[model samples]
Target: MKKKLLALLLLFFIGNFLAPPVGHADQWGVITIPPGKPIKIGMGTMLTGDYASMGIDIKHGAEMAIEKKGKILGHRVILQAEDDGCAGPPSVAIAEKMCNDPLVVGLIGYMCSGGSKPASDIHNKYKVVMISASSTALELTARGIPIFFRTCWNDKIQARRAAAFALSRKWTKVVVLHDKSDYGQSLAEDFAENIRQKGGKILAMEGLTRGDKDFTPVLTKIKPLRPQLIYFGGMAAEGVLVARQMKRVGLRKTHFMSDDGCYTEKDFIQAGGKATNGCYVTYAKEPDPEWVKEFESKYGPRQTFSPQAYDAATILMMAVERVAKKQADGTLIIGKKALRDAIADTKYNGITGEIAFDPYGDRSGSVVVVYKVVEEEGKRFFKQMAF
Candidate 1:
């Protein structure tokens, strides 16, 4: 009996030694590799409603970046996304959720300026760093949110550029139409201010809301003013919609001008089949060669915000990689604060332009392009205007 008991004890000890500690096998994977936790980045954008097209473009770009970097980076990358709806309340709520999630170390966007600025406050409080791809409200940079950064230039720069481009072309009498949101109102205000400063006059100004299907009311109000050009500072969808409405109202003489929000190919075609002819908008045009080819091959001649959003995601990834510490198993772990500094210090060439940030987390040396929509082969093609 003593020998049998000794044998049982030996077997039990061997079993314990061979098996993983209780609950550890479940916590860790079967591979027994040291846990180099993957970086988690969150994204907030208007992935639905009227702005769905833009949101999809941004998402596609971001996803492509992750796919391209997944293998090369050693550690896996994960994305968590929520819809901000391009509004204030939803944006704040989404940002709050992302910042509160401990696993989420960084954020990519709230596509519109209205959404991004408010969310920046939430990110600041939580110490979560965020980078915006499309948000361009000047107030976003002015607030001095330390962790807030943007891949795209602000409305002030684009507005000033548009004004100069227009005046250079001698479109002195400019009318302005803006969406009621902060982005539209502020950009149009800046554009108008610049126009006045440059010895031009804003003959008329009009406003519209997010869901307004009929722009006839505003168009009629501005039609009689007869300005040399109409600058619409808002989204591409709204730009196209309003352009079509302007054509419908027999108000086609004035040249249509817009900000970066109106640069995409889809918006021009969606507004009306052929109404986009002669419309101009500011864009960041030098195509991202690395992504453009893959995107073109995947999307088949479709153009979208994939390049910009990809850059935003890539910047975040670079930041994380810079700060991550290798664990025993050769896995990496990065803290949020380190990630922010890495982002600020970044100087890599990105899909957009050089990925460098100014003091206020805005890109440096970024310039806007003015594109004129012209019909060719029964389709609208954006040609870079000389001005």
Candidate 2:
């Protein structure tokens, strides 16, 4: 009798445990926050090292939006930042953390394309929605993930614009360099295609690993190529180092160009100093007339994509208010499906531009802007070019 009773007990426990977790939507990833509780929104971006300022500026932009919006469905909204250092492993860790937390309804960023590619898979596994602040890898949209969206423009049109800019400058002989990451490689390839289309010659194509401080070896090789333009498809940190080394390697007279990755003026100016002078960069857009006085009053200055980050956070907050359901006990419930739908259907005009998403989660409209690093009034900054 005792043996039979123990077997029956084992079967009972197994049946209950395997019953498929029967619960209301509140018990799922979307927690029903009671009144006075804060709704958590997660951030995945670099917060340390040479790239820390970009992510920190993005966080401040989101804070500015939250401050303006007040709250979400009567619950205070809070940002939970898990610095990923713009690398894959740390980004995955933050994605896991957000997935495990029931209150994290949506996320703001995975700033780097390499990080976003892998981290996006984890978000998909758990059905969490993420809108990126500064990731522009074309392959990300190629994946067709509904939950992934980006406020920044991708490399497609930007590459063409950059190619046109090079041709217009009569710098037909160009050397293309990339960091070998998803963002850098794709941008290089896309830009190369356009460069060829515009009848420009690619003198030499080279690849460098990210976080590589020494570019002298590569610089020595490319210097002899005598390319009219040397375009690096990488971020500001590496680009700055390369610009400084180009002078060291006797490539000082060559025109150096880069894409959005090298658009952070402050970092480039600080690191590259006079090396960045006459350097040309292309970006989707910059934050101007974007409540700059108010933003700088609180957060110092606008760096890189801070305005777009603000818009990304504001868009998420708006979606939260749109999809949140009020319960009888005064708690708010944000269902995963409803929030995703709200984001998919977004069409709000943001400070950066129109905040809309297409079927592939790409913005409906984007324009590439070019900048030239110049010194004016004893200050070095990127000056917007008309063409």
Candidate 3:
């Protein structure tokens, strides 16, 4: 009887030793970082192709934030960046790969809306958190993906603001154009709806391919309409081409307006030269001047979405710090659900503005600003106009 009792006791000790500790694996699972190991944050953006500069700017902004906060709970923070190609397929691949890695606690981007829309599903399935810096498609938040959030203003708000600005200027007869990408097409549709509802007339609504350089044909077809304004819903690559070709096709007097996509100096204003002057574009309001100066000093001239990216990264790190618990043996334990809840509850005062998230993971109280490209002292730059 004593031998049998001893055998039973030995089996109990071995089973308990092999089993996972009670708190280590929670309902949503937990991330365990052994001593001296780095905590990873994943970044997905278009590091190549036409929009490479924009993505590079976002990456730099996130890097700046990570560098500013040297470590989190005594563990070094490392950013693992992947190029999403600004398209659906590559973004899906990136999402799958990054979320599969247990070390990655959060994500910072999928710069374009087209990429973000599809990649969001993969992130949601894994319950990993992702915050985009520039993906502004309305449907992104509408789908109720709990893991996805954005620092940029939604296209619905931007479209309404753009339409209101145009109507206020009495440019009622307008032509709307889009690149047919997810971001451009949806924004163009919303703007058109707002214009019609506000008693404006749409002279023509057209779709253009993104990479095609020549827009003279489309401009020539619409020349006879003599619309007061042409609103192009696309990025800088196509935006610059359209602006330049509009002049060539004798639409010189027609006003040109666009969304945040073309709001860049190098790709739009400088590339379009005199054609871009006097044109209008809508983007988020200017960030704090001191913050801008510091960012420019560290990363050259700032691009369109760097400030938003900085805010996103900062907010993510803050949430990570909040939920991370240090173990007795120096191993860090982070509950995935706890981190998500903390992020959704974030109310941060960032360089951009007061940052907060709604239940849908959308940033609340975002402001959109209208800017005009003006020539001053023989150089071109964006001048903020009173909306």
Candidate 4:
């Protein structure tokens, strides 16, 4: 009996030693590497909605970068796309999903300010870095999340450029309209403040909701204001409606302008048709890279924000490749903090131009130029008219 008891104890000790501790096996499998598993990155953007075209454009740009690089560190790269719908709830859901993904090293987009604000909060929890292609809300940089970076310049810069252009064109009496969302409201405030400081007058400020199809009442009110310029701090989805309504309400002679919110040619020009002609937009300077021709060949013509998305993804992927630490078992161990540091220090000369970040994650050497939409050969096109 003594010998049997001793043998039983020995067996128990051997089992405990050979088997993994209680939850060890489960935990090991959680973050363990499959040597042949492809590295996955994610993109969060609008896949459905009026602004869906912009998100699709950004997606094309990211894939273009991946195609250019082929693979990162000899591992095949997979891109996972998520739809944030350019709004709050969608962004939160995507963020939570991305946080749960242990293999997703980084993210490429949250195209709008409303989406990026909440989504970034979730990313901070996992120390995952995200680079925005089109989000330009000033508060995003002010939020001070080190992991959040953007290829696009903040509205503060874009507003200054717009205000400067308006003043130069002698558009002194301006009426500002906003969509009340983070992106719209912040940009309206910035541009209005700049315009006032530079001796331009803000006659009236108005607000609009995202899905409102009617603006005749506000246009009627603003028509009497007789402002030289009607400035809209919103996307083209609503900008086109406002533009068409302005003309319908006998404000055709007035100047209609907006920030990059209406830079898209597809939605704004197509929907507004003749009304969008002569509308001014402030957009980043177009620096066509040689590879853009290649991208255009595979996917249709690049959208307004596509180039920025390309740079955002390429720089993030380059950072991932630069800092991926290899383990003894041939697994790439990408430390969250290390990847963040690499992005912060990124110096790649991307297709959009030289890419670098400020302490607040805003790109440096950014410039905005104004474009005037004109119809040529019965097709609307953006013509460069201002610096």
Q: What is the TM-score of each candidate against the true structure?
A: 0.87, 0.91, 0.94, 0.90
Where model 4 places Cα greater than 4 Å from the true spot, the runs are 1-33
- For model 3, the run of ten residues with the poorest summed lDDT: 20-29
TM-score of the candidate numbered 2? 0.91
When summed lDDT is taken over every stretch of 10 residues in candidate 1, the lowest stretch is 24-33
Clashing pairs for predicted structure model 1, backbone only: none
Candidate 1 lDDT, 283-365, residue by residue in tens: 88666676687887875554456677899998887777666665567755555566677899989888787878998888888
Measured on C-alpha atoms, candidate 1 has an lDDT of 0.80
lDDT of 3 by residue, 1-387 (tens): 999999999999999699877665555777777889989989998899998878888898899889889899999998899999888999999999988997899899898999999999999998889999999999999998998989999999999999999999999999999999999999999999999999999999999998999999999999999999999998999998998899999999999999999998788897898989999999998988998898899989887898999899999999989988898887888888888989999999998899999888888999889999999898789999987
lDDT-better candidate, 1 vs 2:
2
Which has the greatest lDDT? Answer: 3
What is the Cα-based TM-score of model 1? 0.87
Best by TM-score: 3
lDDT of 2 by residue, 152-233 (tens): 8888877888999999989999999998988888999899989998889998999998788899999999888898998888
When summed lDDT is taken over every stretch of 10 residues in candidate 4, the lowest stretch is 23-32
- Candidates 2 and 4 compared by TM-score, better number: 2
Q: How far is candidate 4 from the true structure (C-alpha RMSD, Å)?
A: 6.4
Q: Candidate 4, 189: how far from true, in Å?
A: 1.0
Compared with the true structure, the alpha-carbon lDDT of candidate 4 equals 0.86
After superposing candidate 3, which stretches have Cα over 4 Å from the reference? 1-18
Model 4 Cα lDDT, one tens digit per residue, 1-387: 999999999999999699755332321122333577778878988888889998899888888778777777667888899988999898889888877887787898898999999999988876778999999999998988988999998999999999999999899999999999999999999999999999999999999999999999999998888999999999989999999999899998899999888998788877788888999998887766567788888997777788998888788788877777555566776667767888999887777778899999999888888899998897788888846
- Between candidates 2 and 4, the lDDT winner: 4
Over 4 Å off, model 2: 1-31, 288-290
